[model samples]
Target: MSDIGPESAAGKRTLRRALLATRNGLTADDVRESAVALAARTLALPEVAGARTVAAYVSVGAEPGTLALLDALRARGVRVLLPALLPDNDLDWGEYAGEGSLARVRHGGRTALSEPAGERLGPDAVTGADVVLLPGLAVDGRGLRLGRGGGSYDRVLARLERAGTRPALLVLLYDGEVVAHVPGEPHDRPVDAVVTPSGTRRFR
Candidate 1:
């Protein structure tokens, strides 16, 4: 991993590269197995179990998979909201009906993403969620998350704060991504908990 800490943009970029490299090393089978375990563990969380609506994203590439959990939540009659990336990099949400309800979307030159094909719910739709699942490379003991530096979720967090919404914020990760510390900024907000394949950890 790069020697750069997580504070500076360069440092965060370095950390993100290192983390992506690590994730890239995992095989397809390994990711599937981990995804199953992650879903089981995440489903057991009280917050998730009690949530009637969840704001989450689809996993592309080697990111900890959310398909199983998303389906499970939907089966339980929970309203699942999936994000659609806007041209400006902000996210617009749509309801997740099922695997068939998602469409492959390519934003600019970036990798194609699986987004909801249903009605556009607008960005503020996230504020109505009981739980929000954030995508991250790593999270510290203090619950600070190291994202991919896209600034999309940053905007989501900011919007939630401005609306005075206090939904339970959670991140799904592999066990190895739980580090002792990560870079933090004034706009960076700490998550309420993290769910890994092994278990879930909460922070104050």
Candidate 2:
């Protein structure tokens, strides 16, 4: 249990290190259990239930798993869109057919990511989604999200804003990752809600 209080005003680097260190201690079984519960909890959200299209990402390393939810969404005939990382760190969109449709792509020195193997739908394709599930290291009480600092999702949010589109923004994480506050930047965007293995919390 790390203290990520608003008082610390901890810099993004320090907060991310603490969050990532905690995640790294999780066992495979722990991740599996969290993933199962996360799917059940997230699927219950009205936004997810009503979404015609969802833009989500694959779980990598010790992050909360998302494959279960992705599969469930597809099974419900919901159009699931996954991201493919671009050289500039922005994301490209693609359809998630299933586990078989994902390809393992390694980006330089970064961890290999599981991305859609089918046709690329372009980055702007995300604006068409009813919901966008963001992968985050941690979220605070205000629903402010701490991403991997890749600027990829920041681009997505800006793109959506520029398009005058406001979709349900959500983040999935373990309970402990939900804290009192997290470092924020002018470009940082807040999430509408957060889904954890324990349950879901709406910020706005």
Query: Tens digits of per-residue lDDT for model 2 on 1-204?
Result: 233455344577788899899999999999999999999998999999999999999999889999999999999999999999999999999999999999999999999999999999999999999999999989998788988878899999999999999999999999999987787666677899999998899999
Q: Write the per-residue lDDT of candidate 1 for residues 55-174, one digit (tens) a residue.
A: 999999999999999999999999999999998889999999999999999988899999999899999999999999999999988898999888999999999999999999999999
TM-score of each: 0.95, 0.95
lDDT of 2 at 196: 91
Q: Residue 135 in model 1: shift from native, Å?
A: 0.4
